[model samples]
Target: MDLTRFFADVDAQPWADLHHAYGSAADIPGHLRALAGESEEAASEAISELYGSILHQGSVYGATAHAVPYLARLAAAGHRTEDLLVLLGGIAEGGADEGDSDEAACRTAVAGQLPLILARIDAEDPGLRRAAAWAAAMTGAAGQVLPALRMRGKTETDPRVRAELLGAMAHLDPPGTAAEATGAIGAHEPGEVRIVALLACVDGGLPWGAAHHAAMLSLLPANDLVQDRLDLERNEPLQYVVEELLRRDTDADRAAAYTLLDAALRSAVPEARAEAVWAAETACLLSRSAPERLAGAVEALAADPADVSSAYSLLAKLGGRAAAAVPVLARLAGGEGDPADRALEALVAVAPDRAAPLLARDLERRPRALAAACGSLGGGTSGTPFPYDAVLLDAIRARLRGGGPGGNETIRLALLLGAWGSRASAALPELRSALPGAPRAVPKALVAICPPEHRETTAEFLTAAARTGPADGRLPAAAAVRELTGDTGPLLAAVADRLTPGGPAVQEAARLAAELGPEAVGLVPALRSALSGSVGERTSPQLDADAEIAAALWRITGDPEEAVPVLAGVLAEAEPTWMRWTLGRAARAAALIGEAARPLVPALEGLLDGRVQVPPVVLALHAIAPEHLDGPRAAALLLEAAERDDDAATALEALVALGPPALTPDHRRRLTDLAERDLRVRASGLEPGIAPADERLREQAREAARGLT
Candidate 1:
């Protein structure tokens, strides 16, 4: 508790080299120093930033551990007990979106500080007691913390504090605590108090599958990512909240949880429904089957004016299981708004049969709806195909022939026709004629709609648009000319003549040329010249120039040899503030080189020092050299990285590549659990936005672990 001694003890660690959310923990010393300085505003700001960085969202980083002992000292010396306790609780929880190993690392970090934290659980301040109680639960210091929690629960007069203590006690799962948990969460308790008690009860093996399951039915979701109306600034994402619950729910409460979620979905308030959506999404992940239990609620909400858009999204997430919503979705599709197309997509997802007629009728009634309708038709040609291709194409052609179609509408029609590829070939001449009016979009449309021969002259039209056609249209024009023409020579000439030295379309021209890849191998020198200035000195807008130039060099040369040294040197030091843009492109180029990038490994490892953009840096490592983890320092990071859900499979593959000796029992268990979840996620058809590559990575991780198990 001696502040001076604590500061010296903490300061001795090489804090600068540690990693926080954005970058190095080097800046952390300055913040901690400010906390002990005179400025209250600076101290408060330091605290706020700390929450975002070390304990970002709800995930803990290695720097998080390094900071805790110092923070514990600060709290003990009475600098800021209440807020510090709250932050300690969150850090102790680590990142709920990850596996147990990651959380265990967090607990391990705080384990030595338990006596200091536990002593505060029964403090005089109710808020301090409440926060410390939560922290104790999170740290799993049941032996030291539980007795204090039980003592505080029985005698604490303040309802909120007592409820928090009860919750912590329940989470520890001692004798007679179930009855205490139920009592604490009763109607007499406030919603906030009930939420704490219920989560603990659920965590303590209490089944939420009971018909009148109080825990699931009550407790307004406070997670910032899911609910509104609450403090949006501080909540962990819904994914984290759900993972925390599912990971702890040994009670198999999926069915009853679904029933509660159904009720939450129908709640009149939007925020409540959002929370329900979070729970529903979690249900799909945990159940290994489609969440049809919430179908009726989703169907009912699909028509609710306040809920329509989100409801359609939920149904779309349900995929083929929510077939019951088709009629409602079909009705909703005819109505205009953002939700309408989403509704149509949901309808297609379940019942493409009914969706076809609905789209056809809507197109007939609303010619302006042509783009949205045609855009919906094939859904990139991979979704439900254009069943009524004849009807939809006829409507698109008819709308374009009209004397009054607006420029934007014209562009939409042309683009939709282009997306059809060969299917819209017959309309090429007409599309070509319309190019004079809406030249910018028509050419890109022609790129896809017209045969290469018919579209060759369309580049001239796009070039003219690139010179004028309002402000925003030029980039699209240059992009289109580059794509539609499939000819890089003229653009590279323009890149030299007009695009460089700050022409209106300079960036776009360079970007378009980069797409030319090895075909524009001649432009390598020009591209390399653009990357000369110090990357750290570059601003955000200027960073794009560096990335494009780097990408162009890598793509055109089929090697990163030229750009690698410059990019690696730029990223070699503590990254500049605007470094994410450059870092991503650099890592990408390094990834292209793969194992050949051995020389660049040390530089990428510096970025993975648990700082900002750790994922990409880790990915870069995975791409360049999974074998790098065989070294001691990188190997330790790999074990922790494997515990993260996002980083898990990739990290597992890396560890497995190191062979059976590196594969521990804990690692194998987490791997098996994640593999099972990936299968469930794929079967449900709701990636929610995860790439298909994630599933492939999951499979690869399993194959890598095939023999070790």
Candidate 2:
């Protein structure tokens, strides 16, 4: 039984050997034990061979399984246990990484051998016990090893051994529980022990460890290690525990507690607050109501205005249950309060109708509050118009006339114009006067308000602005043009002209022309000409303009002949794969424009033939003419493609489109035979290489045959 020779033979054999070798565990360990008793050098060589083979190749066999049992027997035969443990540890660690069932079985065997080894540790010298603990830790079964270490910690005579046990406990709870466990070790143990205990308590939610929370907090001031632990906990969802400590603990402890709590709330998600709310509700139910918990949160909001946003978000989730906090909200929203502006904004968001009248009156007194109030009224729960619209409009107009330093007046004017809708026709003179200097956002609001007859006037203003305003103004001006013209040809042409030197403005104008419906038909030639001229520009400043114009042309003419070629060219030339796919789709979209695109059939067929795998091409051909295979040449080409390995699927698809009338009886029979052959091969559990693709091709041929029938 030369182990090296045996392993070499197994390695030479193929994977099929596994099926014939050791069928059960009983046959494995016995064989290895016999081998181990032969000779020390031979046994070690055998074990080493087995370990290397299993660890590297990950193959399982009766001989490989015997490797561990032989090592254990050698150790019992007065061989060095230290050497055996090192060999076993390496095998166990390697097996864990393999993650195969056989590797897992090997790990189980190693774990079974641990108790026997630990027994050796107890009876042997103190140094051996230390070595045994290290071996046991390597097994990674923390639950089993932790109890043993804890027992050893009680009377292990050597301080160094006890220290190693504490370190083992810390490693066991990697997620911060190590601190709590370490704290619990001796007094009682070392500071490291206490810290591990605190970590364990935080991690495991151990109520018994609550006593250490105060100590851990105190250590935070002087120790960076403790401060790190606090910071780690601050990021955890359970930081609420620290916040609760601040609230329920001594008043003297409140300041430091508040600092930790504030940091946690700032970093936490909405669910964190929900957890806090639930905790607060639970505490209030358990004891008498503690206003301090809610008060602490409210006070934090008052100290920092941004904190009020979460308070409102939390209250919204609490629904009417948070009605108790309404007075706090009201006081915060009141003038002279610290976070009053944000408070009022949040209150309207949470309960807009109830807060609307109060907000309206506040708008008159405080013009800065007017913008926030208007935004609130627009999006708030009321749905009805603002209560004091007349007063608000007067304030807005005054702000506009006064020409305030900031853009606040412009914002106020936009809100007022949006509020007016068609009813603001009386303000036409004022609106007209304000158009030139108004913020870009104002024109869109004016478009929403302007009357039908005045739409022309609005378009004139927008077109003028599009010509004169900054680059940013062009988009809103284009939108205004769309709103005014409502698919008129002149407006469509104007948008196209403005879009020629194409930027965002051109892109927006193209979109506007597309929205104009049939009236945009006039821009097709312009869009096509631009697309043609810019085809080779390498960087068509107007490529997006061309795409948008194509879309507008499709919308206006419903003619595929004019749009498909342009779209195909773009698809072929586009750099980004996604944009190429988009243009390919647009080219195929000609099929969707009704029978008018019948002329695109040759182009689509060419695209499909060119290996341009665009879905729209198939859809276009099907839509325009399903019975398109009218000639002998086309039918032969399809048949020839169907015969080729790579083009088989495409040919089958073409046949399916041509329908049954296009296929002869011989062709039909051939395709059905191919399909049946594939089905039989698959049924027998053999690999079906190109057979599935061939089957799809056959299906298409059958469809073509059926159409001929």
Candidate 3:
């Protein structure tokens, strides 16, 4: 275990010039040395430090590549072998920071130690063998690791090690793995081995036949037995399989995922059925048929008290698409407690019209349903709110008058009344009564629920709040006043006063200033002062503040002199995936400047390489300099992004912005396929209003395709 020879040149390696996530790598060698020390506690602390710095959050750096050689040597010498190997595996697999050269260096460093790693694949210790196999695959030296994994797969006795080896083999040699996957997935293999082999068939692009489906059914609930030593991070095997199958997004693939889950749902075993219900939720997001085809089976499972929570969750995620399940959800919603609350929540999301009457009956008792009802209003068109039901409106009014609901429930009540607009004018007295106790929650609702006759009084109250309210309450109050009265005079001073604090408050103030247009020219100095802060590489409030200020400046003054440079700077400095929100704002601001922002075209085009940037960049280019875009290239990128659930809505919006001429015959055909496809595009992101977003994307795709016609 002597590391004297390995340490000979470690200190001389010019660590001062390199950097990791936290900056200087000079301390990296100290941690490396501590990792080889005898104190297990010291080694653990040292490894944690290294993970934080070098391979921080699955991102490799220059220092990471340099440290790899030492780590491989440590593992070779049996110093914390299992831990070091996993570290090496992480480094090998991590995506390097944008524009960093460490990705290749890190992988090559790991591959250079393949002999040491491969030697441990046959170790007497199962844990070491598993680690060795994972590190080998991540090396991505397929020519070297693939043959070794294939050889080890023949004799690996430890079931977990065998599973790990099979996964490694699949990673290193998909075609070769596909050729052998069927035999490994046979009845004779252990369940874990079969699971990995089945996944390989899916991963290797093998035609998933009847055998694969049967194999997966038998493997349901196998997730509890999986140790996941390979660090695959797939907690649910069935869900992983379903997601992968639907991820291909082909008509055939979606059908395959649907059929598999549909059959699993029929399993008599509650555990297997539960697993299928979970996987079906993902399927619902990726495939349109999933909700209709699987909802009945899920509803049947929900009859079991034990499974109702999970079933209700799935139905809720389906949103309006799970309309077929509303009757069952309604029956459950008629009951009481957590299950009923959950069911009513699902019912509210699935069919608000049906949920309204049910919610009115149990409004005070069903907090979850009331919250869901309130949240649904924020999803789409603010003006075209959910159709107000007199029953629900009366119940909300009664609850507010009773004064029992407080905190989030009170907020929810206010939001529900606000959504009904002038129709909820009767609740104004209740809202006004509740306003003093809950100042922040009630103002926006008051603005929305206030009628024209009462608006002047509401505006006066809000204007007073803007001038003299709590620091956190001023901007929103002022914005509401402007929205109702169309007066920027009072709001202008509030915007200037709030701009100096510099967070979300600043961002909101800048947006409010922009809404004032030429009337906001008085606040341009404050907006410029807000932009005077330092910029960071990633998205931050300051970055968003800069983007908002720049856009506001141009809108207010119609001068690109101050705004254009800040927009260009934001576009240039913001990192793609990490700073996407800021990048998008910068691009949209550039769109506002139009051809005067022409100098930013290249940066905006570079931003196109990121999925989050594509939508805004496309729209920006079309607005700034559409001729700079290569129509086919933009079409190809937009189409690829459209296939992803998270990006589809925005991507299609960009695709439509490209106009019909950008679409070739093939692009048009794909657009038609997407518009007509059962698989949804907008169902994957973390947004609360997924159903509305998905439908919007669906319609956008159809409109884009129809435009071509």
Candidate 4:
């Protein structure tokens, strides 16, 4: 064989020709094999050419697949093994495919090359040595090569080569590999090597000496080792390992180790006092336990102020479980206990309902504490009625009936009503009466207590207040009413009637009406009319009117067929991005309107294809016509959008929606090739100029390619 000419020819030919040459069965075994037996320089040149060709053509070839085997034959035939070994290493690490060859052939080729590859791992050329270690690892020949590599790695002068050797050893796990791994634990090696060795030992289920265990423990900063140790020590019947770990581990490690201790506590082992405290405090945060078990800890903490903070912290974390501590919390709220105020605040914070009655009863006796409790409960009432609702309502009604709307009592009564939610509906007349000359607190309570059925009345009041009352109070009243009624018919009607052209109040009402759902259905036609009016003619008030009307209509009908065309029109006309996005959402909402929506698929596909006047509406189109669009067209659009990096998320979403059949092998190959190049360029801190959408498209392509294989 003319090695120099062969090398020249291999390099001179384009990648396509080389791929074609290697793909041909007849040219691979005999012709390529002859090149492997040439001089070291020639062999090296040939391997480099093969690597470049494989990468450029983006196809694995049969001849390139046999390169390793040819190298092995050269070694056996008494050629200088160093160059052959280096060439074999390059082939292994080159990411070349064996043209979808069988696994048995791959293993045979790898096995044949292993001895020469291992022998030259100590070659004077550091690059060749590192390449050998990598190739040995890539060929999956770790078992045969790991022991020799480990021994050499212990004293290998080059840090980079030593690291590769250790990494290679990490891949192999034949019988007794764990024993070797255990022996390497205390060896003077890189942290990476030590970590790998520890994992190997853990995987092998090898018992550790105290010294080895301590060395493994010292490597706790490596998360893998810490987790492995936790898994191992958790099953042991003794608590010492876990307890010691809790004391010595960092906060993260302690948190993990505590989880195991919690399991141990759950089992039948006799408990230690310190372990119990740690379990009670730490374990409480990780998971739930029986109320009885937690109560024991709570009572212990409550008995001593020294433990009060921990007790309170645990109670807050327990959330609803601390309901049983209501009585103690109530006592704390009372002025009698040592840290009574703090305890009371903590109790109010934890289980407000359970402490409400006590706080209300204490209000007359300890007005300051009562004030604090009322302030605590005044923020917003829970939707569920508390047990104190009837009592609180009765007290407020009695105060009203007594004809004394005087001072702090009035504020207290108002706070009580606000905290009672809808149950305070019974106090509506008193609330209505208190609206006059009553403190701002009274109307705040009225807003909170107002029923969904009275949403119209509330809207009217809010409108009047917005027109004449304090700005702060008016907005809150409107907000509260909007939240309470959702889309009640009367509320929608009030918003529509008061909706003036271009007013902030009208716009606010429109926003509220939209949030109300099917209850606002009556406003749809009005909204459509407003949207149809000229742009300059549409006031903020008119837009508000239109928005509220549209919201009401959608809420009432829940039928997209009745709404999508209007929304699509709005999407075509809306200038603001937020409004455009909302119109898009409305389109989405229409698609969700049940089987009646099947007829809208064509319209959606049209919008998606930019056949209509609206902005690119792929998401809405995808939502409605996922299974209906032309797959190839949709895929092409996705690829094009991805290439531009425009709305990558939406593009990828559309590609995924297009699904498997649309992702042909050619599409996948292009995407994978693009991604590999992009990743390399990005890693080097050079901009690949690939759009975000293309990145996702590449990922989808890679996944699709993998599924084919």
| Highest TM-score model number | 3
- The positional error of residue 343 in candidate 1, measured at the CA in angstroms, is 5.1
lDDT of 4: 0.51
* Model 3 poorest ten-residue lDDT run: 376-385
lDDT tens readout by residue for model 1, 1-709: 5657766776788977888788888777667776776788988998998888888877777788778878777777676777777777778765342365555666766666777788887789877777788777777777777787877766778766765676567656744476666665666766555655555555555555452355445554545312321222223333333444455534454444555666777776677787777667666655444355667776666656556556655665576677766667777777876567667766765665676566655553444234333443222422323344666676666656664556666765676677678778777767766665666667667777666675656677667766655445555566667677655544565554433533344445557657777777777666665554654565544555555566566677867676566556545633544465466556665776677677888888766665334545666676788876544344345555544543455455555545566556766675566565523323223244332334555576567557557
Root-mean-square deviation of each candidate, in angstroms? 9.3, 21.1, 4.1, 19.4
In model 1, how large is the Cα lDDT of residue 68? 82
496-540, model 3: which lDDT tens digit per residue? Answer: 898884555888889989988998888987888777456554346
Ten-residue stretch with the least lDDT total in model 2: 680-689
Score candidate 1 by lDDT: 0.61
- lDDT tens readout by residue for model 4, 453-478: 77677657655654455543454444
| TM-score between model 4 and native | 0.37
Q: Order of all candidates by TM-score, from best down to worst? A: 3, 1, 2, 4
lDDT measured at residue 166 in model 4 versus the true structure, 0 to 100: 51
